[model samples]
Target: MSADPNPHPTEPDVRPHVYDGIREFNNRLPNWWLFTLYATIVFWVGYWAYYEWFRVEPEGARSVELAMTRIDAAKLAATAAVNIDDKSLWAMSRNPVFVDAGRQTFEANCVACHLKSLRGKSESPTAIGPDLTDQIWIHGGDPTDLYRTVTQGVPAKGMPTWGPVLGPKRITEAVAYVLSHHKEGEPIVIDTSVSAPAK
Candidate 1:
């Protein structure tokens, strides 16, 4: 028996080209599907131009950076609003919440130089930082002095300024943590033997 030339007379015609044993049907795609594909392409082009090329809108990274800048500014403003002095710092040292947070910050960033005990050179001769627990202070022994020293840093003594890195809040917390080891009325002995390292 011979096979029929037109398998389905009502269906669309097949393409002349055949690959292996398969033949492709020469049928036009539905308008809806074509429209969707074209629309997606156009949308992609517009999105790329808006975000990548033209930069009309901020992308993911830029958005995050802008958010961070705003947050930093807000934090600085809040810190500035609060009155920070010797009495205030002493009060913070007495508060367990502030001290605990300060301890976490100190352990994370200060342990490398100051050691976990915060005894620094007193605990170990090889320690780079000075003893934080000692009553003797190379810089100044007042609570405000400590805060100033931590913020400004002793560059000549190899201490990096932590104000910019930790921000005012964290630095205040860290100072409170250090102050927790001492009493408010304790005698402050200034160590005159060790001067600032020669510039």
Candidate 2:
């Protein structure tokens, strides 16, 4: 048989190994592709250094905590800005918006103890809280007194301090809702002789 033609090609780029009648060639990658690979590596290093090593920015939990703190501060500022008094509370009681918001808050939080009718012991003798609809006030009957009771709470009487829990706006709204059940000029008799309902 005659010698095989072109038994070994002289192309410098071709590798010595062959598989399935195919020869591998060592070619330079496109400039754009090389540039992209290098860019990605550089970007990864920078991102890791900035976020992990250097910690230039606050992490997720810390950022959320900061946001919550700012929100709380803003809420306090807003609460302070409002003129909260007997007259203002009475006015809020008359306002449909305030009353509605108060009702919602009361239903969510106060319904457990006070019951839905705003009459606790009156509605059911087994209720844990006293009647709010009655003219006789256990804590105090004035609008401001009611607001104070809600905010400060009566720990001795098993009431949770709602000021820090509900914030000022929500407490105000809830008090307004309670006040909506009574007339402004109605008689408010203070009866300290009445004991807190047994829980």
The estimated TM-scores of all candidates read 0.61, 0.61
Consecutive 10-residue window with the lowest summed lDDT within model 1: 190-199
TM-score of 1: 0.61
lDDT for 150 (candidate 1): 84
Q: Candidate 2 lDDT, tens digit per residue, 1-199? A: 9774554557457778999999988767899999999999999999888878999987789989999999999877998876689999999999999999999999999989999998998899999888999999988899888888989999888888998889888888999999999998998888877755544
> Per-model C-alpha lDDT, please?
0.90, 0.89
TM-score of 2: 0.61
Any residue pairs clashing in model 2, and if so which?
none
Off by over 4 Å in 2: 1-76, 195-199
lDDT of candidate model 2 versus the reference: 0.89
Every model: Cα RMSD to truth: 7.5, 8.0
